[model samples]
Structures are given as C-alpha cells and as structure tokens.
Target: MRTVGHLLSRPVAIGTALVLVMLIAGFVGWRLTGGGEYVAPTPSAAPTVRADTVAGRDSLEELVAGVRDGAKPEGKGAAAVATRNADAIGIEGLSARYVAESGNVDEDGSWTADVDMSWRAPGDPTLSEELKVGFDGDGEITGFSADEGTRMPLWLSGPVEVRRTGSTLVVVQASAEQADRYAELAASAVKQVRTVIGWDRPRLVLEVPASGLDSALGAQPSTYSSVAAVTATVDGSSTAGSPLHVWVNQDVIGDLDSPGAQVVITHEAVHAATAAPTNPHRPMWLVEGYADYVALRDTTLPLSKTAGQILAQVREDGPPKHLPGKAEFNTRSEHFGAEYEAAWLACVVLAEAGGQEALVDLYEQTGRGVPLERALRASFGFGVDELTARWRTHLSDSAR
Candidate 1:
C-alpha cells in the first residue's frame, strides 16, 4: 500500500525513537520516516535578473527545441555535447527554465546555460530536475548533463557505496563495515519476505544523512525519523513500469543483528515485493497489519514486548471503539505504534480463525479492489462489524 507518488508532509519527532523500536516489526504502508517536528527553513530572496541572462533564457529554450528536434549542435565542448544528448534522451516531461548565475558565453563562440526544470503531471507528485545545456553560441549545442532530481542524492554524488546481497542490491551511505552489515540484513529481509509472501527481491537504498534521505524521498520532510524505512515508487510516477526504491535510515537501523531490525527489514521487503503503480483502496490496517504478521511470523519475540504499548493503552481505556484508520497510522499521530500493534493483532486473529491462506486470500481480494465487507464475508464468513467485535474481544482477553 506504499505508493511512491504520495509525499508525507508531517515531520517525525525525534523523541519517538522508543516507540519506533517496539513498532519497527511492522510496516506503515507508506514512505514514512521518524524525525523531529519539522520547522521549514527560511527562504532566501530571489536575485535580480540581468539583460544578458534574459537573452540566455531564450537561447536555452532554443537549445531545448533543437534537442527535441534531434538537431545536433556544431561544437566540440564536452559539457555542451553532454547537455544536448541529455535533452535528446528526454526530461521525463519536465519544462526547463534558465538560471542567471549558471549561464556563461565562452570566447570561442561556445556557451553553457544552467536551467532548473520541474514536472507535475495530473494526479502525480511534483518534482524538479537540473539541466545544463552547452551550445556553440551560434545556436548549435556543444555538451551537457541533466540531473534527474528524483534520484537518491548519495547515489548521485555522495559517499554511498554499493554491495550486492544475493539477488538484491544494497546501496548505503555509511561506513564500509556498516554497509556490509546492512547488506546482510537486507538479504535476510528478502529471504524472510519470500518465505512468507513469496515476493521477489527489491533494490534497497539506505542513507545516513537527513539531506540525502530527503533528496531520495523527493524532498518531503518527514517527522518519523524513528521509522526504520519506507518503500516508495520511482520518481513519484504511478506508471505500471515505474521502478521502486526502498529507502532506509541507517542511523535508525544500525543494529542489524537485533530482532527489531530484522523485523523492520522484512516488513519493508514485503512492501517492496507487493508494490504496484496504484495500490488497491484496501483498509490501511490490513495493508500494514498483514505486513507485520509476516515480518514477525518466525520471530521469538513475546507479544508483550511487541504489543506492550497497545495492551497498556487498552487496559487503561478498554478496546478501541472502531478499527485504526489511515489517520491513526500517520507519523504525526501519538498512538502510531499502538495502531500498528492493534492492526497486527487483527491479522493474527484472522489467521487464527481461518488460517494463513484465508488471510492471504482476503488480502489479495481486497488488493484487487474488492470491498472490505464483501471480501470479509467471502474470506471469513463475517462482515466488518462482526470482525471488529471479534477482534475487540480477542484484544480484551489478550490484555488480561
């Protein structure tokens, strides 16, 4: 249920690290990370535009047109030539505009123009890409390079290193030793998910710095830095063939040998394996809870350790009046961990009543756009209300 195109706006609170440790065994079904409350940085004032820069903007547009038309620039400048080739390869449907400080006309009738580009198709998230065009100053291109803004910054030009683990690839912006540990964890995660859900391997990109993580996740500020990782679609595109990336925070999951870490990785692997261009409008609880069920299936951790927070809350306030909704799972919610625990227990109850096959069938049917009530009746011989009552009773007994 973690579609790549949706950007979470809430910043994660750093204080939630404890909650994350208990909840890491489950997936949140979105690109969620735990961090402190987000305070937007002050914006700098725009610079004044020069006359020559205005002219350069026009030249940049012409260069874009020439590239679009397959017209090669008559120049020997490497940068200019690279820029033209990049344009020819397409800008992923983004429009480009010139940046004044980035333009330079050389003495050899050659020139370079720096431009900022952005793309926002209907129903898709908006993102930016950087383009540098080189020209002969005579309307011919020389060289150029375009930075696809949606790519991971560390992967693009950071201290990140890559190591392959089985059929999965692990890219990490951490120390060599840490990277190796993460690679192993990632491979184990893939295996665990395959064992439970039978999902294929997925690419894993882990970033240590906040800046790098932000760039990889399309600049969306997250408040859940304690969040172990997030599964996002490539370039926020919902196309069927769009690539998917699993972004993880190494700072949060540095202890790869821990049960929480293993559960976290496996939970995310399930999301990556089941990723689609558009997720079926199934309940977030099932999407997330089912993932947790798989992640913790083989673990030896006690339910008291995993569901302690929720159980304590239940003992104090009794069972929830209704199921946890999408809002309750959000990073900004104080009961985020409890909601995840509750959802996981719900799946456990389903599996207990009808077996794992039934749980999987209900998940698939709901994912195929089947209504919850219908899927519930067909899969479990009960409706939503009945299931909720059963789950509540189960929780009440478990809490005791």
Candidate 2:
C-alpha cells in the first residue's frame, strides 16, 4: 500500500483532487531538508588585502559623483539608517492591514526600509508571529515586506465587529442606518458593565422590531403586556423551553434616555448574559437586584448618590438585616425598587468593607450549593440580628 504522502506529493497525475495532501507532503519534505541546508563560507583568519589609499582616489571621486547623481549610499547597513528617521512617519490603525512598511534615513546618507506583516485573525486569543524585513542600499531602503501569503494559516478571517461604548453594545443592524447617539450610549454602558463584571465584547446583529421579536419567540397577542420589552413565556418551567422573550419597539429609536434603543439593547443583553445562567433556586432579590444594580451603577450619578437614598430608606423602615427573598420581592411590588437598591448597597458595602475578593467568595458560597443562612454566617460572622443592626447603623451614620 502506498503512503498518503507518497500518493499526494509524488507528481502522480493530472486532474487529481489531492492538492491539499500534496501541500502537506511538500511541507514535510521542506521541513526535513533544512531549507536546502544553507551554509555560510568561512572567513579567512589573516587579512590578505589592504586598501591603497592613494590609488583609489579617482574611484572614490567617481563614487561621490554617483552619490550626487541620486545613487544611495551602500554598505553602511539598513539598521543604522532606520534608527535616525524612524519617528518621521506614523500609521494610524495600521493593524487592520495584513502588510505594513516603514523606513528612515541615517546620518551617513543611507536609507532603511522596514516591512512587517501578520497572519492572525483580529479576535484570536493566541498571539500570532509578525514577520519583519529590513533593507538598506545607498543608505536608503528601496523595498521591504513580510512573506507573501503568510496569512493563509490564520484561524480567523474577518474584522472584529463588536465595539464597547459603555455598558451596552452598539450593534448596527443591517436593516437600519447607524444611529450615532445610540452607538455612543451603548458603548458607554458596556464599559460600565465590564467594570463590574468582565465580559467579552458584545455582538452586533441586525436590528429587529417588536413584531419581529414576537415572531421569533412565536408569542401570542394575549400572553404579555403591551410593553415592547416585556418578557413572554414559552413552556413549563421545569421542562426545557424558552423561559423569556423580549420585544423591541422600533418606533422610538431616536430616544437615548427614555425608551432609548441602546438602553433596551443593553437591558435585554444583561438579561441574557446574567439572568439566563442563574440557577432556578437563586433569589429574585439578588437576580433582579443585580440587574438593576448594574443599570443604576452605570448611570452618570456616583454610586453613593444614586443608591444611597433608597438604601437609607430601606434601612430605616425594613431593617436590611431581615433581607427578603425572591418570593417576597414580587409581593412588595410598591417597594421593589427600594429593595433592589438596598440589596445593591448592601453588596457594595460588603465589597468596600471586606474587599472584592471576600465579597466574591461570599457570592460563590451562597449562590446555590450552600444554604443561605450558612453562607451569610460564614461571610459576615454575624447572624441576622447583629449583621442587620450593624448595617442599619452604618447607613444611618453615613447619612448624618
């Protein structure tokens, strides 16, 4: 039986569909040959010839004349020339291109050329090698380049499309024109969200209207509220089914603050990124509270200013040590906003007092695997009584 390499790279026949195999064989062969075994000739230990200073006076004059005639200075090397003039030119966003070239002039009348190219995709996590070339002739670099077709092996093939404006992703849908204000706000929001918890760049997709979203979710008209961004259910909670569906109102695309498209996009994205992954037993007080926390946190007001008032109110009335669970949050509909604020402030205080690491440890402990009471005890060292008293006092004292 013939080896795969032998069949592919051995120049067997015309009209063969084994080109890829042949290329692989060729690569293996090239690797085995050490690239033709290139070797440099040894230099002589003793100097055999000396320059005759007087005899070459005419030749030197001719050479100087050639230099005057636009011939570049030679033999000084391209590296020296590039060092002197490297700062003269600049390329902005040069990384977008596969190949780039640059050069400089030296004091000794030499020109240098630098060529560089990359073969990796923009979003690839791994570092890809960049190829460089330097050339110098008559002190000026005539040409430079990385190897041609070096990008063939790159794993990614397109430009990075997602951009972070704030806590939102400014996704330009194919159907709509780019809204400058919306994009800016979205980017800003995304940055704010990332500051709280890191996330990869958001994906930009085609804009879809409320009806389009309804169709995607296969929702009936009678199921949900008239609100465009309201969630709709698909099936039973225990069985696997689409739990939530959000619709976007296309008519109000112009607004950025009230019913703003960017806010809607980010709001929905937050629901997808955080809410979908949460365990079923997770408390609504933490779930919705966290989402509201992120949104309010990204606002222009300082954290203390935005959340401080509600926290103070909750501490005074509800006594935050007796923190409510998810079921109770929906029951106290009128106070839901304040409760969420209180939860956020509580978490913020925990982070500030004990540091982020400790708070993170607490969150991990309480999330699902551990009992709520046990996790709280482990994290705070104070039971419901002492911890709530201290927290309420802290809030009251800070307000004063």
Cα RMSD, model 2: 23.8
Measured with C-alpha atoms, the lDDT of residue 356 in candidate 1 is: 91
Error of 2 at 21 (Å): 99
What Cα-based lDDT does every candidate model obtain? 0.66, 0.42
Can you write out model 2's per-residue Cα lDDT over 192-289, one digit (the tens) per residue?
A: 55666545744322223322233333344333223334332222133223333234444444334543454455555455444333356455555555
Candidate 2 has its poorest 10 consecutive residues by lDDT at: 151-160
Runs off by more than 4 Å, candidate 2: 1-190, 198-271, 275-278, 292-305, 308-321, 377-387, 398-400
Give the alpha carbon lDDT tens digit for every residue of 288-331 in model 1: 89889989998788879889989999899999988899889887
Q: What is the TM-score of each candidate against the true structure?
A: 0.64, 0.40
TM-score of 1: 0.64
